[model samples]
Target: MTSTPGNSTEKRQFHGDLIQLRGDRAAKAIWRRVPLASAGSENSIDEVALQEMLFRHADILALGEIDPAYRNSVPVCMELGTRAGAADALYLTPTGRIVLAEFKLWRNPEARREVVGQILDYARVLGSWSYDDLDREVRNRTQRSPCDIVSEAHSEVEEHIFIDNVARRLKRGEFLLLIIGDGIREGVRDIVAYVQEHSGLRFNLALIEAAVFRRGDGEDLIIQPRVLARTELVPRTVLVRKTILEETDDDPLEEHEPSPIEDENERFWRAVLEDFAFDDPEPEVPQPSRYGSVWVKVDGSGFGGWGLSFGAFLNRSQSGMGIYFTWRTGFPEEERVFDEIVGALSSNEELGSRLEGWKRWSAPSGPPRLGFSRNVEFVDGTTIRDFDEAVGWMREKFNRLVSVLHPECWRRLRAKG
Candidate 1:
């Protein structure tokens, strides 16, 4: 069966509307939470809360804060002794009046030495953990044997040994350090500058500022530090650079063109028109609806002719026994012309006999009544077979009528080779 152009256009329009509706719904859903603040009125976010947020949004926390559960879960190995405890612990050392913390196992051993040196500098200037008794305790804690642990004569040397081991780990890049306090401490800045100049190791540092308020009732309002890091502000430009590099490496040698279906509908329509012009002409036709009237006009003049009116066809009966030609009544002169032409065609003995036989077989009975009013009208005639056959007959009769009315136009059309 042939496809109607109108059907294709209607389908395309329906699909376009569906796409637009879906896009509008998606836009509404995505922007719905824009007005709300993500975090509460807390002045600072603690390690626990930070860790939870990091876990929830894994992509953003690729190598940041340590979760408490993760830190305490590390297995203890007796071979390392007390050093095993240090390996598992997330330590916060005093950097002047502020605290500089390192999350457990965040970096390698090489990087750990750099962190320890910075922490030592911070401790020296802050004067919080002096190299006296606490230093001796730290050394005793690290020693493997009882003699080494009890030896207090060279407390300075023992302290150096313990600190040196930590320093070596920091140098090997073994952990991550987070600076947490009210504001930037001089000691922290000095150590940061020192690390930047001496060690080329890249470290991510978060500066946290907190506010504490005490009321007369002895209630303390603790405002936590708001974490700030360079990574959170914008997307990484390095990703874009890498993408460009990859795309450039796999560049194609040649470009391909799109298929004909990708062209616009208008272009397809133009092509179809061109094809039609270059080929044989298609026959003119008329179609009939299921329930319609059929009216045939027969002129008894020498050139006997027959004409059908759609209005009369529809008025015959609301069944498959008539044809309805609505355009006939609207153009009376054209109708008269068509009637004269059909009269001539029907005068042909063979054609007229076939027409009469078709009418006799399909004619409706009784005094023809108007099936409906206004839009619905009946014709004093008979139908023939289905709508398709009726349409074919009507088209032949119409072409004959056109030849009689405008002989010159018909001749001109036929002359085109």
Candidate 2:
């Protein structure tokens, strides 16, 4: 992207067809478009196959620009049951954007029109849905709470706010509907124009054409997927998006100033998170807690147990920090994990040595949290002096702590258990 003194022309870095160049003996791999079709009974590359691929690798959609929060989205389900019909695929972002995608093999005009109309119908049906309505459908398929799905990716998102946002997004018809097709040839602009003309709906629609190229037969096959088209956002959709942005800026929580404690905690965590790299594929970001005890949740069990998570946290008084484990009384999930941890520390000498001198205490009640704590001197006025150095200590402890607790110990326990 570049511009002149007063005017500019938009051009994509790569367009037309894909080519592979590797020095002098290059520019030879033409990489012809491989139509996404069921060539015969032997192969199963059809519309359903395309949807599965998109579900598995959602990052391919290139939809992060519409809602940056979409980076934290997870695949909800494929063929999600809706009044209009089952959508091809459904994705839910942390911010509650209902990303409805419809995959199609656009080798004919009839197919394109059907996809556009079907997606529009899905959007219309979804618009009239309530939070419970959507949740019921999702749970029926994935057996996961709507909040649980997004919260797994973004625990910082409050459950109430997540539900509220999803309801609001649905009511307002603010969905990012993707019409994914195999080599969408011609009539693309018409689809964009069609969405624009429908002033009644406030939907952001994109026509993504996936150009899947193949080189060889079965075993030695090379496949590459490319996005050839994108969303040309319309004025109606843009206006709605602008309104949403304005509302976000005017959020009640953001409108107010933070308290002194909030300020201190904010600085403390920011210093740690700024340079503290987490190893979890989906590391949960920390939100400043009013009480000062906020954990940067990590999957402690290599087996993806929801309750099996513990992260570095500042003690309630901001005087100490630790790697805390969450344990709920009488809950099988947490109890089994706690049992495993105790057994590992006692039986495994190597594991015990790695976590040497780590203190532990538990109250005689439910929701007991155990961890290894490190105290920091909180002598300076509001926050500790040289908070940077304190954060450095915390980072070192967290990295070594997770490496010890999470994988090796947990993996061994999982196999044994």
Backbone Cα, N, C clashes tallied per candidate: 49, 0
Question: Following a full C-alpha superposition, what root-mean-square deviation does model 1 have from the true structure?
Answer: 37.1
TM-score of 2: 0.50
lDDT of each: 0.29, 0.63
The residue-by-residue lDDT of candidate 2 on 221-339, one tens digit each, is 22344444545433223345456332331132221234454467667767766655556435455553322444543355433444556656554333666765655444565566667
Clashing pairs in 2: none
lDDT of 1 by residue, 346-395 (tens): 57665444334222121121112211122222123232234344444434
- Among these predicted structures, which one has the highest TM-score? 2
